[model samples]
Target: MAIEVASLPLPASADPSKFVDFGKEVKGIDPGNLTDDQFKEIQELLYKHDALLFRDCSLSPEQQYALTKRFDPASENYGHGNNKTGSTVKSILHPDLKTIPRVPQVQLIGNGTVYNHEGLATANLKHPSHTTFHKTQVSQIDEDAGITRYYRWHIDAALYDLSPPKVTTLYGIHVPHGKRQTIRYDDGTGDELEVPLGTTAFVSGKTMFDLLSPELKSLAVRTKVKYAPHPYVWMAPARAMPTGLGIESEGRELPLEELPPWEESKLKVLPVLWKNPVTGNLHFQVHPCGVMELLVEPLPQGAKREGALYPDGAHLTDIKEVRELLYKMQRPAIAPSLVYPHDWKEKDLVLFHNRGVLHSVVGAFTKEQVRAFHQCNLAASDDPTGPTADDIKKYA
Candidate 1:
């Protein structure tokens, strides 16, 4: 039987027209064992919708890794490199991921102790909390009152030598139920969202690009972002904004001289917008926290220059200036109305286009609230494609 595809339930604030095809629930097929034809169909569905959900799936780590690798056949390493996070103890990511010894590409994550999970005899996992990384956080009294915040907004990538992953797979092996929580943006706009406990919140990069005014769109298509070398280590000493959108410019980041040994030639300079391979649509895909510079290209010849931002080519190196520019371009897309906070269930598997969306771990779990999950994403074998000359001419 062919897979059954249906739209996921959206919040009342969502624009039905824009979300008509954003995320889908796939039924009538087993994700662990897909036929060749089924795999092709799944691929088409993933690119078209960006996120696909499979409920009540009994997926093994090996199966999850195999499925994720299918999207990028040449990829072999974990998104951050095998056991790399463990060695980089100062990295902000060190506390969150535990590599599965058998399948190094799959990570065992979540909160509380898990016994005999895959190759692990006994694993103690800690849920990443914003209190540890943010400049400020909701107080204990407020948290007990069900107030929380998004931990971080990002794409899964090493953001160094490796290419960004094409997709990410997450399997909920043991899901715990609890009271719902409220996410307070705390950026002074008084934005708040009621989210399910431990929800994985998502915001579409396509929506991020589409919501921009024409001028901003032109600017986005003409820009590239440069990431700091060993970004996680570099940003470890820093703190994030209360909204969790990006880092605050407090001059607390590790100095370049203090960062782990890095090479100028190995720094990543990627386009601000990534072109979707199947749909040909451009996604605003920058990882806001890691970005340190912007390279804006001049407008194409014969294109209108009036009311254009940086019509002449320019390089932006001021950290505050760079972050403010990115925040201005990306913040609107995370409004409650545009966000998708998936309420997970045990035995559920979610596959998302890593290059097409920004996601965050939301809410918090008590020490006793145990949750177990397997996540897999591989560093892609190739770099993302940028806008073509024709695209530049049209947008400019």
Candidate 2:
């Protein structure tokens, strides 16, 4: 199908400078105080820029959560840590367990053990609210030792099988070396991607969610509960077998035990295009972690006995091939015209569409540097067909 493109919605002013005072130094904006015109301008900028960055505004956690409410309700039930920050706010990027001896608050968002039962793998679709939040702190890893503990480029909270978040926000608290960076491949072109400070890119979750294809829509229909087994039991290494099932009989169940390891260890990355149900615009592509490939069945034709031929009927040719394809879809080379880069400053708030853009953290900083941010999601109503006026109202 020919991909449809929506004309970029530019704000009334040709230069973005005229819309809002970029030089003003305020910790954050009170969403309730925003005028309709200002809100419209902010919305248009979010759609056009994919990501926005504010500089030097100091905001308290409570203020950050209050600001998020302007866009979406507080997701009280989603995150894993203390709820003291309020239902809407969640922490991202904290000290490592080994490095920081006694601070439980230092849990890295993507690191530590994947606690399946601790609500890490549950889908938001099952909840009556249809909205969820995830709070993660970044852990330190010695990249020189080939121990990169950070998550590879993937979407936020893929476990939520419902449509991706309508909007996502990342606020930088304490950047290391006075700098933090996030690599964003808004356009597909792998070659000329933009790398900006973490604070510079603002994205709309709605735009991100809109980029998903119908195939993904079908997958999202399957709730988190169905996929719960894999997240809970499989991601981590298995415990040793009991004594009764000793060495002699181990071979009999080798395949069964091995299946979970393969299933859990393999990485899954989704395609970049999301078909917008409301505007029919093909928002920017999203690179989510799971939902990349469902079940890869063996080919009916079987492997070729001859040279260089792939096995017939294989859902995916091989893991290497899958990685290559994901790289092609993910890099910044895909869409050069739409990508934008920004610099980070303290107390800057960004709102973005989860479906439209691909975002990543710059690998330059160490874990102890302290990059603090709060995030929230503006969820569409349960209907997968499209967003309704009611859905818009929920965020409003």
Candidate 3:
């Protein structure tokens, strides 16, 4: 039987035209047990759409891992590595995940304590909130009044040793429902979005690249980003901007000397844009919070240089300068009209292309409001493909 697929429901605020092929809700197939042809067709759909949702699935950690591994057969370790976050106590991610003992590659994430769950006798999960990470947060009064903020906008990657996962699978085992909260951008533009509590907000990296001005596009294709070694630990002392788009430019980042022993050789220097393997589309895929430097190549020879950002090429060492430029390029694509905040239900399985879109955990949950989810993503066997020579020449 042919798979049943339909476009996801977009908010009225979203520009429908831009999301004509962005996300899809696929029904009538059990993802954990797909035939080879079914898996192949699903793979094609996932790349073209970027995010796929399968509702009412009965998936286990073993099944989730199997489904995720099909995307990268050679990969078996978790995206952050098996139990790496638990051991990296200084990392900002330490509090958010609990590895399932039997299925170490699948993590049990979400709020409140879970007992006897998939080989875990007891798991205490904390829902990540802007209050703990953001420099400034809505007051308790405001929070009680239903105001919230985006916890962080990022791709699912360790950004240290492992290559970013190509896809991430999140299965909601227990979903908590509540009134929608208003997301205040708090970046001084007075932006706000009404989203369901704990919704996962997503924005297209393709759209992020597409929205850039010609000059920024020229810069994006020519630039590469250098991530801090042990980035999560490096940024633990830092604070985030009000928008949660990137780090606040304070001198609070941990010094390289203070971070967990890291080698210069292990530091990541990756392209600012990742090329989609199947579709050949370029996605503006930088992790703004972890970036430490920008290595910009000069405009390609014989290409248009008028109004080019770095016609002579430059290595930007100033953290503030690098962050400002990235913010200017990325923030616009996450406006209220461009974001897709999925209202999740129990048994919902969302598969998103980690390289093609940026996503965030949107709100907080009270202790009593338990949310249990099985999250799985494998560190890819290889790094994401950057633009081809033809891509550079065309964009430049």
Candidate 4:
């Protein structure tokens, strides 16, 4: 089965200078029943594209697990990201629903908390059009769901555990229709459009690295960014700008010292520029908000620097400087040309490089919507810590 995976359809009105369809080589992949050779081919395509979107592929949980295992033999088969029970990703609307899904690995996620008694998502309709819901109202909903308080931009691993996940597969179970919106502007003017719903925005670290000023790029490549292990209850940051109707988790890292000890981990310093083990491309691997400190120096002679293993540096970059540069570096990487949200379709399984791209959920499913996706993450196949520190020096 030659997989026919396609790059996301380019935006209709994209500027030519900005947008490049990187996934051009792939076609629509239909793995009626995956073979070992086909799985290998899929791996090849994924490394090449950095992202792949499979549509209407009604793959079951067992099949999904098998495909993920194929990608990385060591991938965790635990159910619902819980290591104890090892559950599956299921379409459950709410966490409170006592009905445990049949599959141990199948766990339910989405805005089940906002659904009606019949399990339909009509909370927004209860307030009439989205326009009536206003920012104050929506922000309150978002705040309740921990978007304003807990959700923030980060690599999933940096957000949760220490070791970063390699590959992530998100299977869209249900997608909501975008509500009509008329956004009033500061100029007393307004714009009309349907809000983008349940879409995930992505920023490529490699692209961000390339876009950096030569001096900054050199500094970034040479520097080692120390990221504190993120807290279990992550406080959210308000975005500088809007990405459609949803909020963007922007700004600096929250203090971890005050948080529980178990919630924190020893700070790890990774090379700012990481080279991909599979594709051999260099990535700007540092997280904008997760950075706690910066070692503005190269690795020691004959030192191990992969997976962010390095001794502390005396010369440190100001946390403020790092955060500002990170924000600046991130902007272009998320420019209209570079940024593409997953315009999900029912049963569309999207496989993306977790290390390579920064992503965010868009539209407005804070607590009361029903867009479900079965997601699985694989541990790194190659060097998870990333490129050698010498590589950073050589490039710098």
Candidate 5:
């Protein structure tokens, strides 16, 4: 508790490295009126500012679960388990919680859920009576040119073997206020390039390892990338539909394939560069649709994977060309000048760093705009926090 950094409180706008605004000197901000040295100055400025917006704050889901357990480092189990996904849609109304708390760490995202009809948004929808499983109904149906893939860039499960969410608070009950949508892409020489639509976006793995090139940062700190969660993810430009971003544990609707064999043998072997123990720098977690392989762990035994983005290096036996050369070495750190898209404001209170930010879910809200959001996650150590598929045996 010695985080006395000059008695904190000086961020009414420090867009220096993008994001740090306690919303014009705090007014509507209330985590029961923060003070414990402002939750260790907001967990040491999100361990070196990856993103932290506060705007007109108006919490009280128990004060957003006691200010997210004061920047929880697993605050006596923050959450990742206890299988969530119980909100068929009563239009979630959280002014100070009249009802909505089975406590899985508060989660009730929007798009007016009811994923597939049941009646006037299922009057007072609240079906969660101590589990019984089997209620499937979170459809996407189909979309690609019109988008609705529900979006996802990912970093949450980071493959999953555990220790994924360090912090990822989000609170902004109901947003999406009209006019703004013009996304397009593919300009490699064939027209079409609009973009503008990056709502809950973020991607800055320490600037993707400071825009690598020290021989691709020594083959990304001697590679270790290997994942296994893709049973289906067709949401690309022309591939258009099939998605999977809301992997609702075991009962919230979202799993389709892959992840069974003891949770895919717990495959998550990360390390395509690492070091961010709260801003030590260097991050490039990699997630080209949940990677499948690439373990050239030889940085000095016979090194030569040609330094990322293949010519003949990042090869894990061609799983679609190592997933398009790791999404073209991670598309310039998910571009848009190192993505940080979060314009939400209805009572904003974002706080990211889920292992170095890599979010998704950007636009499309209209049914008379009612966007809702109230998530929570924490993990630094306390792995294996539920959410499985159970059909493992991956990557050979």
Candidate 6:
């Protein structure tokens, strides 16, 4: 089936009182003093912006959990056992510190120069744990040496090899001076982009999934790794460090410890196309992690090639071409209209639909500043078009 891309609607310039009644209920929320119309107005704002930020929320951990429940009834309050014990409630400092705790459900990312330097907050809703396969660090940029470089652009939750995550949220605890720029662009469009602090945008998951080819799908399926579905799946050219890296084939596990050093520098890409089981909307997301190469072509039969191990097989694009394409994609010229930027602030609580939008963190911030936030994921079995319980049980 051919997919049709939807145009993003621009934000309306209206007085706050014009749209909000403040008396209506917002789906599953009960703010006590808020009226049904007021709640509906908030819902409309979130749908329009893909994310909503609240200043001075002053929510306790329990209150945070309650707010999350308004969006996802099955949301959890704390990180799971797979998460590192000390790392969950407390923070971990960087600089030659190895063996940091891994949270099964949540992930800690960023230039880990200090305990609280612009770190990332991530949670795996599909599968939660106390430990994560990926580690957090600042290897890409050497601070003591005064070297500052951004990581490649890609999506999160690509490592699981399963379907990409539907949604993700980032809350800001601190925003430092001279560190207020993060960049993003739309697919196949080389538009330069910028996202200021305290704003959030909804990315389309379908756009990200559409980049996959039949060969890549086969690889993902054969390996049962989840993301690719099979080895035959292929993707368009994208940017990253070193040569292009494909899933190779199914049936092989790329252990974290055994991967090449440069693999850590690669941006992670997910299947760009997806069908929303409920509202039936399409979403596109560009995740940043472990992405190697973008454009790929099948080799001719009986052809001898440098990286080719078999005749009539698939091969990755040349490193130079891949790098050029990546730089072009990274240029701010191709920014997506769907993205909404946010300003970072303390005591802010934001929420959005993961399956419905794509999101990224803004970089170019100083490490001396602290940015912290807590997150939880919600699971729902009531997907309108998802597999039936019997089918899921049979597959299990």
- In candidate 4, which residue ranges exceed 4 Å CA deviation? 13-21, 24-28, 77-107, 113-152, 158-161, 180-195, 232-257, 263-266, 298-318, 365-369, 381-385, 388-394
Taking all chains together, the TM-score of candidate 1 against the true structure is 0.99
TM-score of each: 0.99, 0.46, 0.99, 0.70, 0.30, 0.46
Count: clashes, candidate 1: 0
- The alpha-carbon lDDT assigned to residue 217 of candidate 5 equals 59
lDDT of 5 at 396: 9
Ranking by TM-score: 3, 1, 4, 2, 6, 5
Query: What's every prediction's RMSD, in angstroms?
Result: 0.9, 14.5, 0.8, 7.9, 20.3, 12.7
lDDT of 4 by residue, 29-147 (tens): 55436667777887877766677777778876556656766666865633224432112112111221122143333333445443432233332221112222122333554423423
Q: For model 3, how does the per-residue alpha-carbon lDDT over 1-396 read when each residue is reduced to its tens digit?
A: 679999998988789988987999998899999999999999999999999999999998889999999999999999988999999999999999999899999999999988889888898999999999999999999999899999899989988888999999999999998998999999889899999889999999999999999889989999999999999999998999888899999989999999888888777789999998888999999989999999999888898878888899999999999999999999999999999999999999999999999999988889999899999999998888888899899888
Error of 5 at 48 (Å): 9.3
- In model 1, the worst 10-residue window by lDDT is 12-21
Q: Which stretches of candidate 3 lie over 4 Å from their true place?
A: none
Candidate 1 runs further than 4 Å off:
none
How many Å off is the CA of 82 in candidate 2?
9.0
**Model 5, global lDDT:** 0.48
Q: Which stretches of candidate 6 lie over 4 Å from their true place?
A: 1-49, 75-169, 179-191, 194-202, 206-225, 228-272, 276-279, 285-338, 378-396
Q: Which stretch of 10 consecutive residues in model 5 shows the poorest summed lDDT?
A: 387-396
